[model samples]
Target chain A: MQAAADLGAAAPSRRTEILDGLKITLPFMVGAAPFGVIFGALATSQPLHLSPFETMALSLFVFSGSAQFVAIALMAVATPAWVIWLVTFILNLRHTLYAATLVGYVRHLSLGWRFILSAGLTDETFAAMEDRYRRLGVHRNSHWAYLASIIGMHVNWNCWTMIGIAVGMQMKGLDGLGLEFAAIATFIGMVVQKLRTAGAQTAAAVAGILAALLAALPYKAGLTIATLVAIAVAVIFERHLERRGQA
Target chain B: MSVGIVILGMALINLVLRCPLFLVANHIRIPGIIEKALAHCPVAVLTAIIVPFALHLDQAPDGSQWLNPDLFATIAAVAASLLTRNLMATIAIGLGVAVSLRYLAVF
Candidate 1:
C-alpha cells in the first residue's frame, strides 16, 4: 500500500515537470513556426525541386534550421556536396559549445538517455534548457522535462514545415512576406537577456562587427571565424579585468 | 549526389557533433579555457548571424541599401527586446515595422 502511494506521488510530479517543459517551450515554438514554414516552402520551390517527403525528412533528421536552410540554398545553386557539408558543419559547430554547457546537467543519465536528448538539441532547445538548468539545477526528473521540451519543439517544427509545403504549393511567393524576421526578433530577444555582463556585451559587439566586415568570405565561413575571434577577445578581456581587480 | 545521400550525410554530421560529448560525458571533463569560452559562445554566434541578416550584406553596395527595411526593423526589434524582453512582443513589433516599411517603400 505504501509503495503504491509513493508511486502515485512520484507520477504527478513527473507529469508536472513535463507540463512545465511544454509551457516553457511555447514561446520558442511561436518564434520558430514561421522560420520552419519558410524552409519548407523554399525547399519545395523552383530549381530545388525537393519532394515533400524529402523536405519533411530534412526537418525530421537534420533538424537544424540554419543548417537546413543553408544546405537548400547551396543545393539550388548546384554547389558541390562536399562544400555544402563543410559549410553546414561549420554552421553547426556552435552546437559543440551548447552540448558542453549541458554536459554537467545530463551527465548522470544513461548513455541512451543522453543520446536521445542530444539528438533534439538546437538553438531554441539549448536556450530553454540552459534557462531551466540555471534556475533550478538538476532534479531527479529534469531529464524528462528536457525530453518533453525537445519533443514539443520537434513536433512544432515538423508541423510548420508541412504547413509551409502546403502553402508553397498554393502560393507563388512566401518568402517575400518578411516572416523570416520573426526568427531575427526571437534571436535578439534571447541574446539581449544574456548581454547583462561586460564580457558578454564585448563578445556580441566584436562578433557582430567582424561578421559584417568578413561577409565577403565564401561559403559563410566568416561567421565561424568571427565567432571564434570574438570568444577569444572576450576571454582575454575578462582575464585582464580580473587581474586589475586583484591589484 | 542523391537527395538521400545529402540528407543522411547532413544528419550524420549533426549527430556526430551533438551526440559524442554527451555519450561520453561521464569520462571526460571540458578543459577550463574551453568551458569559459563556451560561456560566451551563444552571444557571439547569434550576434554574428543576426548582424549580416539585419544589414542585408548580400545586396549590392548602394547608399539606399544601407537604409533598407531590414536594418530599421532590426533596430526596432532590438529596442523592443531591450525594453520588454518579451519574445512575442519583439517579433510582433519587428515584423510590424518591417512589413509596414517594405510596403510603404513599394508605394
Candidate 2:
C-alpha cells in the first residue's frame, strides 16, 4: 500500500514534468497553427462541403496536415470520399514508424494507457523522443518524459486549431506573411537536430534535391520514389564506410 | 472500396514492415543494406514531406496560380532559424514572409 502511495506521488510529478515539456515544445505550434489555419481556410473555400464539426473531427482524428489538405482538394474535385480518405491514410503511413518506436517505450503499460499514448504519437513527438533516446540510453521511465513532451504539444495543437477556426472565420489575409515558412524553419531545426555526422548531412542534402526534382509525380508518388532512392544510396555509402572502418 | 480501407491498409503495411525491426531488435542480425537505410530514414522522410509543400506555390501566365509559398517562406525561415535558432523568430519570419508575399500581389 505504501508503494501505491509512492506511485501516486510520482504521478503528480509526471504531470508537472509534462507541463515543463510543453514549455519546450510550444514553438512547434507556431508551424502547426499556420498549417491548421491554412487548412481551415482552404476547406472553407471549397464547394465540397463539410460541417464545422466534421472539419474539427478531421483535424482531431485524422491529425495530418498535408493529407488533410490533399483530401479536401480531391473532395473539391468530386472524388469519392473513400478515395480521399484512403490517400490520406496512405500518405500518413509513416506515422506507424513513430508509433512503433513509441511502442517499445510504453507497451508494458495498461491497454488504455497504450491506446492513449499511441493516439498522441506524431512525427515531432517521435523525432523528439528518438533524439532523446539516442542521446540518453533508454530508461524505463523515458516514455513518461516523452509523453509529457507530447502532452505539451497536444494542448498547443488543439488550442491553435480553435484559434485558427476563429481567425479563419473573421479574417481574410492571414495567409500573407508566409507563415508557412515556419514549417521550413521547423524542418531546418529537425535536420540540424538529426545531424550526428557528415554522412547524415550529405544524405539529407541529396534527398532534398532529389525529392525536389521528383516533386511533380502523380499522387506524389515521385516523393516516395525519391525517398527510397536516397535511403538506398545513403545506406550503401554508410556500409562501405563502415567496412573500411572509416564511419 | 473506400479510401478509408486504403488508409488503413497503408497503416497496416507500415506497422507490419516496422514490427520486425522493433521485435527483432535484439534477436535478428540486420543486413548492412538495412542498416544504411535506417541511417538515412530521417533525411529521406523529411525531404519527402517538406519538398512537395515547399514547391506547391507556382505561377501561371493566366493569373490563376500555383505558387511556392512554402519555398519562399522556407528560404527566409531557414535563414532566420540558422541565425537565431529561436523557434518563435524562425516561424514568425517564415510565416510573415509567405503571407506578406502572398497578399502583396507578389505572386
DockQ score for candidate 2: 0.32
The TM-scores that each candidate's chain B achieves against the reference are 0.77, 0.60
What is the lDDT, from 0 to 100, of the residue A108 in candidate 1?
73
**Model 1 spans with C-alpha error above 4 angstroms:** A1-51, A65-114, A122-150, A168-171, A174-179, B1-10, B25-27, B61-64
- Find the candidate with the highest TM-score and give its number: 1
lDDT of 1 by residue, A87-169 (tens): 66756777888888788888877889999999889988899989988887676677778999999999999999999888767
Task: Give the Å shift of residue B39 in candidate 1.
Answer: 2.6
Candidate with the greatest DockQ versus the true structure: 1
Over the stretch A4-91, how does candidate 2's per-residue lDDT look in tens digits?
2344433435555466456445666565776676566555433433445556655666565555555555554344455454444444
Instruction: Report the error of model 1 at residue B82, Å.
Output: 1.1
Model 2: per-residue lDDT, tens digit, B3-100? 44433543443344434434433234445465556656656656555655566511221223336556677777767767777655776777787777
Q: What tens-digit string does per-residue lDDT give for candidate 1 at B11-100? A: 999999899889888545667777768778767877887787777775532223556788889999999989998766887899898878
